[model samples]
Target: MNRILIDSSVHHMRIAVVENGKLVELHWESKAHQSIVGNIYAGRVENVVKGMQAAFVDIGQEKNAYLYYGQERATTDSNPKEGRKLKMGDTVLVQVTKDAVGEKGAVVTEELSFPGRFLVLLPEDTREIGISKKITDTEERNRIKEVLKDSLPEGYSAIVRTNGAKKSKEEYQKELDVLLKNCQAIQQFGQYAKPPALLLQEKSPALRIARELYASEVDEIVVNDRSIYEELLQAGEFPQEDGVTLLHYQDNTPIFEAYFVESQAEKALEQRVWLKSGGFLMIQQTEACVVIDVNTGKFTGKKSVEKTILKTNLEAASEIAAQLRLRNLSGIIIVDFIDMVSKEHRHLVQEALEQAVRKDRNKTVVVGMTELGLMQITRKKTRPSLEQQMSVSCRYCNGTGRYPSIDWTVSKMRREIESIFSNTIYQKVIVTANPKVLDAFCGKEEVFLKELQHKFEKTIVCIPMQAMAFDKYHIEKQKDS
Candidate 1:
């Protein structure tokens, strides 16, 4: 059974999609750092660089939004046919396509779209009726296309969402009306509103997910908050005839814990994931890309070594795809599967990987295996991954996960003390450093410190400061203690 569990009783709202008792997708939204990806704003052109064919629009965000007006990149609303050039002091309606990530500002598009439960309304377009690629049934696709053929306004276009399949024309029309009303309201308000004003806000993350799951195989939608449960029902987000049950969780146990989502989500943050077959996967996220390595640990098939490797690789392919969606890891990815000599075996593994990722909401492309036995894949990134959102860089290791070795620190300290003695007339010196480093510097019987003192003809005292960093040391000089 497919179930969407929403836990909104905490500061950060979390949604987990479980299919067949296995967590497949996880999402969270925080009140403090709310996302503005689908927001519509009346923005003022702050700067226009003709050379770059882009403009910087002030949308009342922390950073000015980037708008591309190039011929190829211009949307229908940008009016490329008339050759409209945005200039400073000009106001226009724009929708946020991508949120601000890192130092980059939110990416805005003049082509505005309002997404509904069954359709996404596009304003000022060529009346194109597009359907989702996921709705692959030819007869159903044609039926939906016919239903929405003449329903839209003359200047409006829309894309039939995946869940629109098998829905009644009235249902489609009802959603269309709501979306059209929303679009019209935004346009009418933006005309007289001041620049940098917000015209519309997207639905909250939990409600938004529920609205999108009408046509899915989901049978149950559970919410821990009574208010949210009432809101979902009052909005008529799910069809009553679809046999989808709306349940308000009243269990004293936390919603996530009750569904086993808390433990599953915690595993997504780990670097090593153990497979059921005793094999393990090493997943590492780096600045450039995410790298995953497959290892056959303690898994020896009864048949042969080749069979063991192939089995492990096939299993890993599926887990890797699940991890990508669960962790929301995006951008370039390189996978190093176990070596297989047969060309046919490699093809099977690649096919398995491609099939597994098809269920992901984000667009993921597999670029095939390389000559060096590494598979390259690319996933679209609109926001930070789960790791980036949940954790910060380690201060002790500086995020490198490595510290200066004791031998290295001890050697460096000796050289620094020698240099200090040669440069100054101090007869005594006191060195303070991390305890672990002090142990190395003092040696087994304080022999190292004694040797250094004899060489410098100075009384040296070593103080271990637990608070000091391993890579750091401080020296104080005294004139004949």
Candidate 2:
């Protein structure tokens, strides 16, 4: 049984998932006044590239929004147009599909779907009947599909969620009618509302999760906020007495700490994750993909070499799965597992990895291992990972783990002095820097600095400061007497 608890505050929103009374997953999202999700806009199609079948739309933002032709619904009002059909001044209704990232604008789509408790209403595609793949029962799927087929309107579609499984036909029918009514209301509102307006706002994250993920498998839903708990109870979706407990935490101690979730969350942020077998995995992420390297740290197996390698790889498989869920890592992932000798051992290790990842909620596919001992895997990415959300690049290392060399700093200082001499009328200049930086300026680079002083006809003095940072420096110009 798994329990979920949400802590929503003004600055940060945190969610903890406990399985078998132990914390398994913890997620936090910071609301720093820069949210770009679920924003609807009236965009002007700026440019339509015929070859790419895409257009760049200006949505009154710094960067242009992207719209793809395939994302647009097949409508009856569309003319079979060719050669740049969309013009510059054309106004279109667009919904943001992807948020604006580094150097890229928001990805918008013409076809929009509003998500309800147990259904996603697609206003454009009516005949399309879909169900969540997570529900494996064929009879339940067919039952839900039949209910959706009867209630759906022309030129609209409703995707039944996983929660619809095992629900009675009467219950499903009732929910479908309620959802269809809401969709109709939204459509009517959209017709009367002004352009660049939001017709339907998505539910809050907590409510959204409950609608999407809450099922018989969930043991309890604990929330720190009383108002949100009351709202969930009022919705009447989650039953109180059927082992689905909704707890309102009022303790002075933080709810996350009570569950030991904060410690697990801190471990997820680290680059090196240690395994119980004394082996470790170092993970580094870039814009392209995440790279994981396996290492045999303190593990000195007294067994044969082949056995040692197999044990390390086996340990890595489980840790890799846990790290993926803990960090919310997604997209292309390359794992460099410790090389094993036996083919059977390799196959067993891969199978172990597949079994370990079965617990994750997100869909993951292991594409098999390569000859170079690298295992390739892909996880569905919905948003930015935990690291990108919580951390920034180091100022000193600039994320490369290398700083400016002493010689480079000395040369840069000389250039600054020369620039000041050519521009200003200072008589003496005092340069203060760390011991290493000052030593480079006075030791091997002393001749260069002296030549610059002679050319400028200005007195220059080097002052070494031990307390200064590696990158810290100061230049002071002495007034003429």
Candidate 3:
């Protein structure tokens, strides 16, 4: 059964999707992060960089937002700021196209989109009309297009969402009207409102995902929080679907923990993943790209060496796709598969990776293999990855996962002592560092410490502090030894 479980009682809201009794997707949103993508705002252009063809807009936030000139301009005539350079004080209607990731601000666009249950209203332009690519039936697509012509606002266009395929004209009209009214409200508010004001707030994360991803084929939606449960009921259209049920889970245990999702989520954060065939994937995420190395851990095929290598690469390719989606790893990716001599084997692995990636909702491109036999895949990135959102950089290693060694620390300490003696006059220099660094520096017989004192021609005291942090130390001045 395809089921969705939403837990909102905690500081962050979590949504878990289980398909055929296996956890396939998990999304987390913190309540404090009010700036979600797709929200409409009345922004003022703060600055324009002509070289980059981009503008920084103020959207009533701490950091100024950014937007490209051709953010969503499909055609030249569709450009709202047509043939005119946006100045520092020009007002424009914008929407959050991408969430703020890392030190970057949210990305906004002049193109406005108001999404409803079965349609996304693109106001001020009625030139474009289409149906979802998922609705492949030609007849149904024509029917949807005809219905859109009638129900859509005069100066607006829309894409009939997949859920609208089987709906009657009246149903489509109702949703279209709601979206039109919302768009109108946003326009009215943007006219007189102050710059950088929010015109329309996006729906809650749970409802937004439900409407976009789970509108069809979802058997049940179970929410743990009572308020969110009631809010879903207030919408009053989801539960009306055939055989679809809305459940309020009031059990003592959290919804995610009870459904074995917590365990799966924990595994997703791991760097190494073991496949069923006993081969493993070592996944490392860097700033520029994600790298996955395939290793034949314990899997040995019954056939020749070529067969074993092919089997391992095929298995690794499939798992790489799953982990990318499950962990929400976006941007450029590089996969180093076990080298195969045959060209046919390489093609089979690439095809398997592409097939596995088809199930992902995000946009991905397989750029084929590089000269070094590494497969390159690029995925769209809006917000930070799941690991980045949930985890913080380490204090000592700064997220590199490797701290400086004792010998390096000792070297750094001596540099500090030398610099201190050259700059400041003191009778004795007291070096206070962590026990590990002190042990490595002074040694058991204080050989290094005595040599340092003799060289400096000043009393030097080594103080081992168990409570001190490894990466930090204090070189303080002392009048007496």
In the range 215-331, model 2's lDDT, one tens digit per residue, is 427878888778888888887777764558888986534566566665676576779989888999999888799999998899878989888888999999998998887787988
Top candidate when judged by TM-score against the true structure: 3
lDDT of each: 0.82, 0.73, 0.78
- CA-only RMSD, every prediction: 15.1, 14.6, 14.3
Query: TM-scores for all candidates?
Result: 0.78, 0.74, 0.80
Q: Rank the candidates by TM-score, best first.
A: 3, 1, 2
Ranking by lDDT: 1, 3, 2
Error of 1 at 98 (Å): 2.2
Instruction: Tell me how far candidate 1 lies from the true structure as C-alpha RMSD in angstroms.
Output: 15.1
Clashes of 1: 0
Candidate 1 lDDT tens digits, 1-481: 8999987732356778899889887776654577898899999999998866789999999999999876564465554432368889999899998877657899998989998877899996589999989899999988887888867788899998877778888888888888888889999999999999999987777787677655568899999888889889887767567778999997645676677676787676788999999999998888899999999988888898888999999999999999999888899999999999999999999999999999888899989999999999999986677776555555676776544444444555665666567666778889999998898788778877777677667788888899987778988988886
Candidate 1 local distance difference test against the native: 0.82
**Candidate 1 lDDT for residue 222:** 93
Q: Where does model 2 exceed 4 Å of error?
A: 34-41, 58-63, 71-85, 185-195, 399-481
